[model samples]
Target chain A: MAITVRIPTPLRTLTGGADEVHAEGATVGAIIEQLEANHPGIKERICDDKGNVRRFVNVFLNDEDIRFLDGLQSPVKDGDTLSVVPAIAGG
Target chain B: MSGETPPWVKGALRIEAAVLRQVEADALACYPSEACGFLFGPADDPPLLDEMRREDNEADKYHRLDPETFPRTSKMYFKINELRAVRALEEGAASGRPLKVIYHSHCDAGAYFSQEDAATFASGGTLMWPCAFLVVSVIDGEVRDRKLHVHVPGTNGFRESPLTVIE
Candidate 1:
């Protein structure tokens, strides 16, 4: 279950400059957990201090916004691509 | 009854002062989240700000307008009032005047367009020309910034002009 997760610019620090990373997981949450396990601080950036996803961050399972779908529980199969895009504030 | 003309309309076709004021006022009403609305068109010179709606929920803050409020569907996108958009289009077509623009707000943000905005523009479904995109950001419920963008098919796609509020 090798999955590729695309990281946004703000989260690049934890990934050591890797914009995208490969992880193995049966679900999106599992993949995120795997990412946190490897990078340590990446989870904090995606989720709020209280653990819910930040209102500004949108995680897409492929091109579809996860909120309209199953949200964080949205499943991911082998070779799936997950993209995390933060709400950009700059004009 | 009087307001500054829309910053983009200049010498060619000036948007009425009243309409411009409404755009600013509506933008402020939807603070902490982006506001959106329908620009009624084709009757006068520079379109009219006929109807306005504000989404206060901070569901998705990806662009100037909240994404959850303006969802991506097949034909048109988001929570826009279809009847209003249709009526504007119908009248514009009948009068041979283009609807001219599809406007929205961007709270507490600058005026430059973003990639999400570009993707929405490139969806290629609605009026493409004279059809401009507007952004208004309310900082602490004060309209600190406003911007207008028109598509340039030949260039990178949209040309932006910042708007100044006149007191």
Candidate 2:
């Protein structure tokens, strides 16, 4: 399945300045791996050493949080859109 | 290094009087809990405050997700709703007035950037928005202090910036 991944500005450097890109996968994790294969160093920014989404990163599958769904295992298909948003915090 | 104003500040951070009042009121109304919002303005030197957009502080969501590691409550910190943030960014882009500042309140604490704040805002040594941050300190339903800081490129950190309230 082909999916469109929206890359936020902070991770644009690894994407050759492209704001969005297409990758093929059956699940969000697989899509991320495809992205890594195409754009090196991008996965480290989104996932931690344990291969889990970073604490400050939010992955949305068509405006719905993946964490609320099946997390990285969330299923995807052709034309699905995934957004990687960095969590903003302050005190 | 210790002075009323930091010497590294290029100029005073100018904000509109009405906008400041609104931010102060929003912070006061969200008493004991942190409040967050976005500021829009021109992309010029010392950006002007054209408008303020307030969003809910969804820190409780994290507390419920993992109370042990994310121990902070809604009364301590803030997490801007991701959906709301995305909408705001899209609106800002469509209007040609990008997000110029991010404002939040610190309950019962001085207006200083915490380590977590630095890590989140300046993650990967790059700021999501090349704008300033406004930290408003509120105590007992009153505004105590407010400070502005801007990221120092290549330093991987932020520096105190002077603020000037314009009428």
Task: Report the TM-score of chain B alone for all candidates.
Answer: 0.60, 0.85
User: lDDT tens string, model 2, A1-91?
Assistant: 9989998877888889888999999999999999999999999989999998887888899978787789899999899999998888756
Kindly report which residue pairs in candidate 1 clash with one another: A91-B112, B70-B78, B71-B78
Writing each residue's lDDT as its tens digit, candidate 2 over B104-133 gives 999998889887788887765666555578
In model 2, residue pairs whose N, Cα or C atoms come closer than 3 Å (at least 3 residues apart or on different chains), thus clashing, are none
What candidate 1 gets wrong by more than 4 Å, as runs, is A1-91, B1-13, B41-84, B95-98, B123-130, B162-167
Candidate 1 local lDDT, B1-167, one digit each (tens): 00122322321223455676787787666555455654544445453443333323322432334455335321112233323443454576577554545556665566556666664443232212234677665665677766676655444356675433333
Best by DockQ: 2
TM-score per prediction, in order, is 0.44, 0.90
The best candidate in terms of TM-score? 2
Model 2 in CAPRI terms: which quality?
Answer: medium
- DockQ of candidate 2 is 0.52
